[model samples]
Target: MKILFTSFLYLIGGFFTQSVAQPARHRAAQDSLTAELEALRVQGHFNGFGVAIVSGKGVLYQQGVGFADAQAGKPYDLHTVQYIASVSKTIVGLALLKAQELGKLHLDDPIDQYLPFKVRNPAFPDVPITLRHLATHTSGIRDNDFYLSKNYYLRPGLPLAGLPMTFDATQTFIPADSAVSLPEFLRNSLTPEGKWYQPKGFSARRPGELYEYSNVGASLAAYVVERACGQPFPAFTKRYLLRPLRLRDSGWSFRQIDFARYSRLYGSTTVPLPYYATTTYPDGGFISSVADLSKYLHELIRGYQGRGTVLGPASYRELFRPQLAAGNFEDRNERNPFSESYNVGILMGFGYTGFIGHTGGDPGVVALLFFDPTSGIGRILLLNTSYDDRPSEATMYQIWNTLEKYQHRVGG
Candidate 1:
């Protein structure tokens, strides 16, 4: 009698468990997201664009729209690669953090410790600039104002000087007397001995005390990583992050990758633009496809979930958190409390508060990669054309709304 009663209780317990638990959710359909992206491509007059949805385990879906080569009639596919612009900065950030984890460098170390040249804010030479400051854009560094300078075109090997003229017929190219390497560009632009040195390339405030956006600072950080790690920046990054993440369709240089797979960039007028590279490759130089980046984002999400081995959990935790608070720049629109070199506290589109990611834009490209650590879901969008006036904030809002509503949730 006792055994029969116990078996009855067990059966009842199992029934209750089945009744109370949530039913497994079928994966959302991908058709809606694909159709929406295609519509957006048409509406925006984009030459080509790619979108991807990712979760902790892997990519949910990735789709490409429009023509990679309108003349050739090559329809853009998930494998069509293009420059991701400033999005590359985030990769550089991860590389630097990886270096730190390997005991190759420290975040608080002074710039002079690793850089071949001594770089000081001319206004506050007494205050030292640290890697932390550079990563947070608080290094008191500023843009070169290159176009306004006489020698801007005179540095033959300085890629930035030639890029504008190469891509736009209206822009004039002045011939240079000599070629300059990446290291030379930095030395000339920052040191007192170099002719291109300008006092205006720094803020009046001390390092780590203010915010000023700077490509120079970011590129410098990458260079420091290379010096500390005893390897070229691109090589180190490939071995450490790209190879491990299986982002095979990504690279920094045109010479290194399969150029045939590249999506030719377009202007607002639908004119194909010339391919241009930069000496500051670390700052805004990433050529990739949606499929490749989806893998990268998944790995990043895994790290956030404490299951990643590529980077220590503590490092990934600090990567997105606000590194500086007082006097830090905060953008309510992005829900970014502060800007780290590669990470931001993003509040938009993730369906949750306190998400993180980065955005990138150049003359003819715009890309965004964002993910929520709490939910382990993320979105990526890449466009291959630029307008006379950059797209407004409304575009991002619409994108977030659409993805939030339609993206398939997998394994959640």
Candidate 2:
């Protein structure tokens, strides 16, 4: 009788264990992914990462992981800031909209009207370039890359008269063969003038022919900001976005000392020349935190339509709306697990339900901002090195999937 009773007890214990435990598939997948991510982190693979989720004017997800500076043992957190490259364009676009709202400029205003510089091309004399053209990348001008491929040389970057610099660059970019600024660069390539210049054998076509990415377009667009606001790009951004949004820890400028508190860039090892300063600061510059970015997304989502303080709702709506579709991007081929394909254009970007914020990737960082029009929701992901030193756009989309699923629970 005792033996029989013990057998029954054992059978009952097994039954309860099976009933209470998590499903095998769920446990296995979670455990596997967790182990993989942890292993990657252990090998000093993930330098730092920050993510924020917002719902109902509240932050539902503000989390950080990995190290800000592993050498000193500083940890990544909500306060940790990182360089967000091309993502700056979206912010610059907002500044332009604000300028238009203030009546200092118009999006449709031609570039020559606001800028001191003029394009040397006479073929398109009747086709004047406008802020709308630059904003939409239809200005028919080439990006800095075209100029860079021409002047690939070493030269001192001295400030030319009659130009408002977007950011400070220690070294000037060359076109692989020629050394000259945009104005000088144009003269050499198109007009057949400049020292030791050889043409790449291309001409600036008429505006609105098709989509072409241009750092020059971005810079010129920001120059419009300088023209409208009478301040450097950084100073004007602070007044319009940072101050009004109450972003306490975010700024458009950084110091050499900032490297101490700033998250170091890494690609298997720290970048030997991991500098963020560039002439295209309006295009791919600015350092910010995840927490502040979440709020920035919030402002974009509400369009300041009487819901937030950063911008007037009508003006905010204009910023988030896609102004142009410049190109189609194939995201599936990205090497990074987090890579996502986003087609970029002047004055416009999109994802789900029309225009969804923006995304950017640079030397050691890849970032994304998400906003759902149907739900008026937004989130941000800022990582030190793309997950595992690769572009992690897909990983970001997964994170978006997770948060959007949980959003309904939090009234998002």
Candidate 3:
């Protein structure tokens, strides 16, 4: 949501495969979901956890079963918050649509057209980039580079832990062992002439050429949103998106001491990093409670229903539309008649029978948000654990299909 992170060495993950074995209307459904959450907790998930499901108008099912801090034994409550991570992108997309509806900006507008700094010059013979490209991740930029430095080069033997905080997607990141300011990371994003790659190299071709996911692209879009409407990034979001939706607890802040509600980090014990002591929460800085997230999901699934003053339904639809294909992905080529495809391993919910949202992952947090255009069945699963496997995307598909298998059971 806020910080930039590097590609984590994602190995296969194992999930408990026990059947739900409960009825949606019976108390058993809630109990089954609760059991799963508790298992992750006892297994030493990040910290406290919470989840709820809303349908038609209100929450139909819900559960919260864990603590916000494991050692202090601070139990997670209805208000305990978790960093929502890349899921913030969808919120950014929604805000942009709101701006467009207000006639403040247009998606077709080029990046350079809106920025005071020399943003990506799409009109130039080779590197044509656009806001649309930025939203759908079509910009040829290989990584999320925030304020890329022209002379920046990846230093040799850069410990994966100590690299500067950045939005640059190219800057490989591992968790840190030292102190780094959030503003420093935010500042680095603006340097080095805003190139696509750094430390090694960058993509030369213009936008719209490929589906290269760029964190800098998203960060730059945030800056553009800041510039276009003459408001700071966080303020603009609060005014256009957060406040209007009544997100009382949502925010992007750097002050660390006061925001004490959080979980701990879990990495490989063999790696031997300090347990329950290390955390770098900039890339995925957006934080809110599960109740708030459920509300957000409901509004999103409803297409921000009746909020034409905010963002129209049609514009919201365009946000999930694929603008470009990020290369070096596996799903496109994997011809599994039974398996679902993916964007990286995010299990792109778009372009499938279900509509698209995104999942976010850092060391201790993994979140999945999905919306079904047909049934209006939306699911948001924010696990406190790093549950870092190919996130139950396929598993989620199984859930949807199983429900379809016995629609009479769930009565959808």
Candidate 4:
């Protein structure tokens, strides 16, 4: 399965109960975990970082290190927000499912029913493109080959949208608003009359047959959500998910966050990268902090356990549906913990039980958010630098080891 570059404000977890009445042993474990994270931050030279541990009940431990603004000397903290890149897919996926729960749309319906234009694989026009195909990376909508097409920049007459059209994940700068909006881009690309139209965007394989990752498919799904739900994607999320959960610090864009607490992204050089924005906000535009994310994690764990959650439990099951075909190659290695099979938007594999979450990487950012619902434990890691494909192996190994240790101690 292709690795996708791969929210919230809430108070669902047991923050108060654990803080006021936690057993002494659990508190000691948290202290040691904090120290180890500090050592890892120092040793790895993380520019800015946030880490959190969440169990079924609530956040067990959380911390931050380095700087939100390095030159200005702003210390990174739990409230610091960072762009999560492809991880935004998970949020979009959840929202789409929620739309389904509200009777706004059905996952099995042909996407064209909700879109202004039809999108059928040119090679197999008889087949319908469904929302399930989009969520699972099985829609056969591949990204533009910027190297060959030099189509990175959006143009007024271009019928096709480029990879950058998906979002500003690795783009040096955000595009102007005059550029094609996500819905316009999708309509143009999917409709024959639109400029920049090319049969190449669609794969020769049948929809739901192959696993080519496509940001186009993801953002397209969100547009469908907007059309079906009668609201902008970000606005809908805020109304139904963010605000209801009381996630005041997490949002769909930088403008929604506190500048002082927004982490500066870094590369190998001393200069920091510019923040990103996207017309296709559904793809990779969400920004969040560990504190906010923990609440969401708790909800995920709760849903996995068939309990209270912001998104319906049935929706959670759909979100975590394994999308891997029998023959697909797994990406697991010493550096990667996920199985070869991909889920709706999140990945699967990790720990003794397993995990469901996504990893993200862009020019100057890397992040991981996953939870082992079986163990009622989850982890969130955010870094301001894209140092490697994944974070350092030592850091990951340490995280798993810590989880195992903590799980054993708590008899989870």
Models 1 onward score TM values of 0.81, 0.70, 0.69, 0.82
**In every candidate, how many clashes are there?**
0, 30, 29, 9
Residue 381 deviation, candidate 3, in Å? Answer: 1.9
For residue 171, what is the lDDT in candidate 4?
A: 41
lDDT of 2 by residue, 34-95 (tens): 34444545555456777655543555445566777665678887778877665677787888
* 3 versus 4: better lDDT goes to: 4
lDDT of 3 at 21: 49
Q: Worst lDDT window (10 residues) for model 1?
A: 7-16
- The deviation in Å at residue 351 for candidate 2 is 2.6
Ranking by lDDT: 1, 4, 2, 3
Question: What is candidate 3's lDDT per residue for 1-412, written digit by digit as tens?
Answer: 3222222111111011123544446445445556655664555423445655544354444455665555566777656666676666666777677677778788878877877554443333345467777766565544443323221222233343632333135423333333233333433433354332253223454455555555556656666677788877677877877777677666765232125555443332112112221122222457776667766766665653433334576775565444434363423533332222233211132433334556565435656555554555555555554433344333333333332332222222
Candidate 1 vs candidate 2: which has greater lDDT?
1
**What's the C-alpha lDDT at position 323 in model 2?**
57
Q: For candidate 1, write residues 346-402 as lDDT tens digits.
A: 111121145566667665676777776666777777777764443533454455457
Cα distance off (Å), candidate 3, residue 296: 0.5
Best candidate according to lDDT: 1
RMSD, candidate 1, Å: 12.5
TM for candidate 1 is 0.81
Q: What's the C-alpha lDDT at position 45 in model 1?
A: 60
